[model samples]
Target chain A: MTVPSPIELVCPAGSLPALKTAIDHGADCVYLGFKDATNARNFTGLNFDPAQMREGIAYAHARKRKVLLALNTYPQTGNWASWTQAVDRAADFGLDAIILADPGLMAYAAKTHPQLRLHLSVQGSATSYEAINWYHERFGVQRAVLPRVLSMAQVESVIANTPVEIEIFGFGGLCVMVEGRCALSAYATGESPNCNGACSPGKHVRWEDTPRGMETRLNGILIDRFADGERAGYPTLCKGRFEVNDETYYALEEPTSLNTLELLPELARIGIRAIKIEGRQRSPAYVAQVTKVWRAALDKLKAGGAEGFSVLPGWMAELNKVSEGQSHTLGAYYRPWK
Target chain B: MKLALGPLLYYWPHQSVLDFYADMAEAPVDSVYLGETVCSRRHELRLEDWLEVGKVLADAGKEVVMSTQGLIESESDLKVLRRIVRQRAGGDAGFRVEANDMGAVRLLAEAGVKDWVAGPTLNVFNPSTLQLMIDAGATRWAVAPEMAGAALAEVRAALPAPLETEVFAYGRLPLAHSARCFTARHFNLQKDTCEFRCLSIMDGIALRTREGAPFLTLNGVQTQSARVHNLLGDLPAVRGQAEVLRISPQGAHTRQIVELFRATLDGSRSPADALAASREWMVEEPCNGFWHGRAGVEQYVAA
Candidate 1:
């Protein structure tokens, strides 16, 4: 019997520099989206243009790294032309695959570009093996990016049942609810993660100085109020603190980064085909460091037991130096924190 | 356009629910979609009781469409879905089913049923997805609540001929659903052992932000906008695209809402008067932003 190589490290890059950095740092694949609502990271100063996407794909492919284009946002009813055009352009760019969430887009892609390898986006929120199998049977989806809401046991169960390749989020900002299904953002800012690729967009975010301390708000809803000397986290909707009964608490999720760096060996043992890093809006240097560390850790795990190699220390330290406030969580991978 | 009383997303008292629909029988709404769309734990109306309500509405000259649960968590949920798709009134044939989740779609499709309503929770954002549902058995589709009117026009343009499009014109917009029930969690109850506490709040309990602004409403596992979406004014603009307009049932003044929408559609009431009339019916503020591709909270006025 022969042991297969460990799961590939699929990373994210919001810009050309980040893509190059990730590719140089041993990323097996890199995923990014266009600079529009067609992709999920429809932020102010992130994502690629047509020329940049073409060049970025070439840059990654030259380094023997696959480039997956994220055409993940659900097409707005009348403006599906832009989404359709995005898919056509992605195929024309010789991209490795297009990660899709919408069933209509999947049907269109399957019909128009039958040869283009399709990976189901996590935004599809396909939790069960039956749902995954539905996409596989219907659209011939090559891989399915498992939503971050699932547990490792669920992942194992899904892997056991589905023939499609499985990709799990390894690091970055964690969503408490299933992706593309959540409307908490829309509840506040009128923009939603499902429709607009952004959750708690920076344009709506504000850090205000109050008599209490520093109050962080998104779309005028105060998420957190920090004391004078206390650290204030980014005002994301899910990470916000709210009063349920009389006690104030984090209603959605605690403000934390999802770091499963220590669970690499365990994940690899479970037949996960790919491990993905979730931040597409991070700096190039941040991408390089995380990718390099994970690459080294994965290589070490392949050699033997992952003894004396814990990504926790380096990952925590490096990420802290970049952006850290109070703590980090393993998200649904470990426990469902209240 | 025909009027569809969307699924009862809230948990009213069993008697109040019975009374509400009984009153709806006299209302101008053409169709009534009964059963639970929020959580299965909400047992104000069981399958038999929903069918019973359907009988009264049917006798009153209203079409009855039994809706399936949106978040099908367990095998019991699947069983409920199966019953909705299979159970027929008076042993004639199954009632028209509205498939909310993909499981419902799969169940109905496998049963060889060819006419169903694709519930808004199906997230049919484009024409291709709409066509897929139509091919699978859907004769009509309720556009996702968050979809803008412009986007809807595009979807309508690409839709296969004869498939009716229903827009969520009124009611508290269902924002999202999860396995974890916020209402149950509010009482510090685990989801599995939830004491059916969701029934206490006739409408969902409103969740306010730290600044004391209305943020959202929690109904079992489903989260909805605190602001009820009133698109009566914009109805004229997109009226051509929609063959049916859905008015979701609220706890209070639901019959009045039905009348207002009906009058507006019938040209008896102007959009401005209907908009003003809506204020008297809603428990919270109204928004029409998602219809304009703006924030869901912004009530955009047509220029």
Candidate 2:
């Protein structure tokens, strides 16, 4: 049997401390956004500005670790020039790769900065090999962040067919809907990951102490209600409980973060190029813990053959402690969940 | 201005879908978009049935176009899209292909087709993106449902002449698409064994708020607005922006709704009169908020 090459461990860094922490904890590459709406993780007071990114990139490069910049949000006609300039700036910075979602931005980067590497953001919504191949052929995107929607078998099939490198989400907040294609956020909040780089935007998110329960609404539309003792997750539209017929249940998906710890061995066996950790909106503590645990797991998988590898229980406990939904699922990776 | 019937976003029984198009053949519409752009499990009418339906509408002197699935997940879905592209590539069918997904766009690019409708799901927000798509072969493009009319006026002004613009002028707006099937989840079943529950809901299933306000509609893997997007009252704003107004199909009164829009666009019916007559045809509250540059669910009637 052939020995599987160790997969690159790409981690998220919302702040400078998080970037340093990820690099210290053995992340091969740290992906972050600017302090504006150019990237998907456009939260308040998170991510790096130009000077901060310049320092972060310098720190990562000095340590022989790579830095990825996300210019992922789709820009409308009015403010598209700003987005284009940001793309050119990323090229000038000499970053490892620029992750993007919009076709317009993708075209600009391909034409203007032909030498820079492009990674298709999950928000690109290229679920199949055919779509992945299109991005590769047209925009010269080197890798695509697979949406959290494919089964493991599907992922293998896509990898076998396409020349583009594969990047799968290893841990963090999971989007139940396909990224980029979803507008449930914008429908209620007038903002989406596609245009605004935020979903269930914090400005529109409000919690009220109702007699029924603690109700969370986005722009005045109810998302989820938590009982007094129940732990409330962040209010995104797809994760909310709503009335379908009569019984109000999670009509789209129950709140659960995707933790693919057990699939690391399988993912490595399938020759996946990188394992991406989400949640740049999370604190440095989260980026540290997630990167540390995944680093250990990947090391374990590499030490032994994939056939003898098993997920350590200690890693599971560490991850669930930081999980948003108070639980974890294999998500669409487990065929039954898909 | 030309009026195009958008592909049916909901799953219907084989007969009802056939009947809807039979009635549409005589309606005052310029083009007909036929196919399952939603879920692949919607097999009441297969690829052949859609081709037959397109033939009927084309015979009635309508420019028929076939649309591909918006989120192509599996190889099987791609196989179906390839067949649709091939059928038209032969140049015998004379059907225009709507590249809803990037996968479909890739296939269209491979076929070296003359023209395609860059579907609303394609997210063509700016003029440069639209221009690049036109360079590839997009003859007409649908504006994103979230896009404002003011933004569209700018994009139209930026673009060179001869490109047709279409807007989602009516229907429950298709807000999102996902791999997980909501309709199957409603019945407590997996997507693999979904039993085609969407067939029962002629229109998509209405998802009301806990407070009993209509919020969103679940159509298989796709989510749409509960309020129907009606732009008849906003005809003054729409007239300059779009050369074609695409009305998405609904369960009932679609033919009448098309005629109302046609009469309004042709100046035979007053905007207020059209809105008044359209009340009975609507299954949900009418809104033109997106065109007025506000929240999509709001009516935003001009003062």
Candidate 3:
């Protein structure tokens, strides 16, 4: 067994309670966004406001854990000031680092707060080492959260080349597309994750119950319908079934969550610096359960190394309960999934 | 305003691609961006062939620009990109290249290519990113396809310096790209093992919602809108924001679409007249709602 360097467990915290729960569950760091459209999870009733953000930071810092602020959305032309202000807020709140997607925002943060650390958000759509290095060269980005598209070998190759620390999605809702490059949400609804920080924004969503099934539509575009006693995932555009070549199916991808619990040893062996859990829109109970499971898995890996590590059944069951569609996949990490 | 024929986003027969550009030699377009911007597996026209095609267009009194692939997934893909960058910067220095992704941007900037087109996939929504592109030596940049007219105006107003702006004026809007090839998946084949099925469909295969509403078009890895995004009706507003109007190449009647747009820009034809003339040429319905800051699939008409 090889000596494993401890990898940071970056958990999501949508609220103050989630932040504290993550820290208490042995998260090395908890990442979150603000209440405004400046961050990716700009859903109503989600994310931290200024007071909660300050409180969350204090809670994490007191426990010797890091708090990362995600200002991961691209600022529109007229709204550039708000994103810049968000960067300033992160610095003022004494955040351990700012996870940013926009190069323009990164430029602002790098110039204004020279002391603050920056992690390239997955929304940055940086897949290769060259792209990550460019962000590092231009903005002094210390870490990069890679888009969930690379295979295992590709991930290893990227980590081998770049000095910037690499982070990969370990668990959560799967985005089949390269994060920052997608415009499907904009096509279906005028709002996009890159511009509006929300995909299939709540305002555009409409659900109806028919005698045939339960129907979900976004911007009047019928996304999906669920039959009686059938599981219905959130009607994200990509996950819905569509007809291609006369057959109706999930043409892009199925409604599934990415679970990398089985690949923990391989990820560690490849020298990934951090493992990220994606869903700030979820509940605090979810944060607690996932954080606890991941914490246990990571600790077990640390104790036993690659040769002895194995994912426990209880941990898998715990994660499955909260996974989208109550199912899990390795996503693009496994070559077959691609 | 200038008209540009964007790089072909579909796979076609080698002869058809050659014939298409050969036809473009006589078409009313100011710039022709030549390349395999979608899948790198498409080698019907290699870098050398594309350069040869570029030379043909250049000699025909049209500005030629080569575009790199939007998504680079493998070492071979990067190698191809590196070769394209080297050829553009070194031997084929007469024409410019368009950087589609940040990888291409970094490569172009690193190779000291001073003047290049920042393609739409670079995601330049605000002026700061556009300014950064200018600083990195991009002489021109295309606005992301989803940017409305008001947002475009706002961005243009806030430019750090006068940079050439291009807009996606016509054709099916490319909505998303992924690692897994939807085309291959449709054929029930793995990406590596799939016989190039994208070659069969000159245009991408149509994806409709289960309710049979035309929704998206699935190419190999890229997903596009089922409806063609025609901004010809908004030429007056677009001309105010962008110096060049880009028309993405479609399966058929591209030259006619280019002619109609050219005539509209020259004021020989009214936008409504041009819109009516171009309707039969489009594979799908027309939509300009994205330009109006509405859902892209919608066609909003002002009362």
lDDT of each: 0.81, 0.88, 0.90
Q: What is the lDDT of residue B260 in candidate 2?
A: 97
Q: TM-score of chain B only, all predictions?
A: 0.96, 0.98, 0.97
> What overall lDDT, based on C-alpha atoms, would model 3 receive against the true structure?
0.90
Q: Tell how far residue A40 is off in model 1, in angstroms.
A: 0.4
Q: Please give the C-alpha DockQ score of model 1.
A: 0.38
Candidate 3: give the clashing pairs.
Answer: none
Query: Local error of candidate 2 at B112, Å?
Result: 1.4
lDDT of 2 by residue, B143-176 (tens): 8888889988988888877579898898998988
For model 2, report DockQ.
Answer: 0.70
Q: What is the docking quality class of candidate 3?
A: medium
**Reference-based TM-score of each model:** 0.88, 0.98, 0.98
- Model 2 spans > 4 angstroms off: A1-3
Better of 2 and 3 by lDDT: 3
- Candidate 3 deviant stretches above 4 angstroms: A1-4, B91-94
Judge candidate 2 at residue B162 and give its lDDT: 59
Name the weakest run of 10 consecutive residues (lDDT summed) in model 2 chain B.
B86-95
Query: Judged by DockQ cut-offs, is candidate 1 incorrect, acceptable, medium or high?
Result: acceptable
Tens digit of per-residue lDDT, candidate 1, span B1-303:
899899888888889888988899999988889998777677868999998999999999998999988765444666787888887422455579898777677777777788889988777887778888988889988888888788888777765586788888988888877655677667777666777887758778877777677777778778888898998888788688799999988888988888888888889999988998789889898999888877787778868
Error of 2 at A223 (Å): 1.5
